[model samples]
Target: MPEMLMEVEEEDDVVPNGRVLITGATGLLGRAVYKEFKDNNWHVLGTSYSRLRPRLEILNLLDSSAVNGLVQDFKPHVIVHCAAERRPDIVENQPDSAAMLNVGASENLAKVAAAVGAFLIYISSDYVFDGTNPPYKTDSVPNPLNLYGKTKLEGERVVLQNNDGAAVLRVPVLYGDVEKIEESAVTIMFDKVQHSNKSANMDHWQQRFPTYVKDVASVCLQMAEKKLQDPSLKGIFHWSGNEQMTKYEIACAMADAFNLPCSHLRPITDEPVGATPRPWNPQLDCSRLEALGIGQRTPFRAGIRESLWPFLVEKKWQQTIFH
Candidate 1:
């Protein structure tokens, strides 16, 4: 808790007047956004559908009427849309439901924002790419490979179509702690180490640009403030950490950060082995965001250290400790 407080203080120094409305506030990124805003004295209002309790308001984004009602009632100056069907396998299994939530709900929010003249900051993904390119720029055409990516892409388009003054931020793989890291790419590898006492056959070939969850939240708030100040800064932008590395490299970094045995991690080639297709390359070029003076603050090792500390403290391999 003390460490979390210190981190909050550091974030507060960057942004003042943090009043915000965050969707998916129960998730890792959402929680981080909430804290970032709250620490900065921003009157934050959050929404959540799952049983997971949020610090502020909780509403189901899938419910259209509910979303509309909340937006109208809250009259938030900024809306950070973080809620979505993020799982690739589940999204593939139920594309329609994913569309309903990811696309439909987002459009509803956009409409509400327009009615109230609120600034919108929609969180997007790097999965929108097909993985053929090493590092995708903001101008690159999106070629999604899966239902999740397609749905998120549609959501982005919906927001843009609905609002002329909206900011859609495409971020890469985001990692942080609020609950256990059961499904995250980084946590899955940690699970392998915990049970097998050996690293899973590492797919060293697959490259991904991982963004720290807190940094992502910080950028979101900063972008929201920028949009509020200058309405013309409207369009799609790429936001990610400074460095890019393969899954094996990330695993090694996490292991080294936590003082764990890295020998257990073994390198493997890029080969598909499951029903879901993974992009071999999904690194994003964040120069667009950097030009806006919103660069990643935490280095890979430090971010890994911050994320791994809770698991080490709990003596349990959990992805998040707060939620």
Candidate 2:
């Protein structure tokens, strides 16, 4: 099957002169970031640990020497660290691996960033919160409940401690059409509905702040460029869509937008019925990103509509669902 072409908004800004290094370029979010910078005509260098077919520099982030070598070679002015073990359940099961990738690799990247004097933008998660608050602010103290969140939070600390000029943007659920479906809840749900006639039975009780992948990447690139030009604009910022939505709401919205049946939905609680601890609420207040001139352009429904088109045409929806 031919790869689905992505529809991105054209921006007139020329890619800056300095090189930009993006880790995890194979992943959905990372790939979006790569496209954003590449479109601007910036000299883009990317890294991938497993999927090397996409033309990214093959490098394991855990390899400190290799990371150092890449830094020396590329000499990027901006380093967007998007690589991490992001599976919450898997991270809880295997913390050591998660720690190695999320915490240790991040520290290594920070060291390289400091050595090369590069502006580092680390992608963080709203899961850093313990779900006690409704809308988390950038200044909110993080109390992670799961290993994945803990690891990412540690990564955030590593970037901040290592480089005072670094910017850490904490985002929530990211929804978009991408090659991989493993890490995207929105894609997973949409696939289930489109192929298996199964719908996500999300608890209307649990709510979250979701951002479009393209929007998130755009914000990250803008922030990185701004930070490169002005050293004083360095700190942690919260980046999320403007609204708070439950999983059920999102699923229904997808179904409605795509003309899919929504009857398969089953209501489940925010808490795990048998095992695992689920963060009931992971909503973030993105006023900080807004103030920095980075915010959501399309509404949730419109974004979902745009994302669903590729799935409908590619007929790959069935491939995305399990059972």
Question: What are the TM-scores, per candidate, against the unseen true structure?
Answer: 0.88, 0.88
Clashing pairs in 1: 18-42, 19-42, 19-43, 178-320, 179-320, 180-319, 180-320, 181-319
Report backbone clashes per prediction: 8, 2
lDDT of 2 by residue, 29-90 (tens): 89889998988778999899888855689999989999999998889999999998887878
Off by over 4 Å in 2: 1-16, 195-200, 313-323
Query: What TM value does model 1 have?
Result: 0.88
Question: Candidate 2 — worst ten consecutive residues by lDDT sum?
Answer: 1-10
| Model 2: residue 303 alpha-carbon error in angstroms | 1.9
Candidate 1, 104-163: lDDT as tens digits: 999999999888888888889898999897588888989998888889899999999999
Alpha carbon RMSD to native, model 2: 7.9
Error of 2 at 16 (Å): 4.3
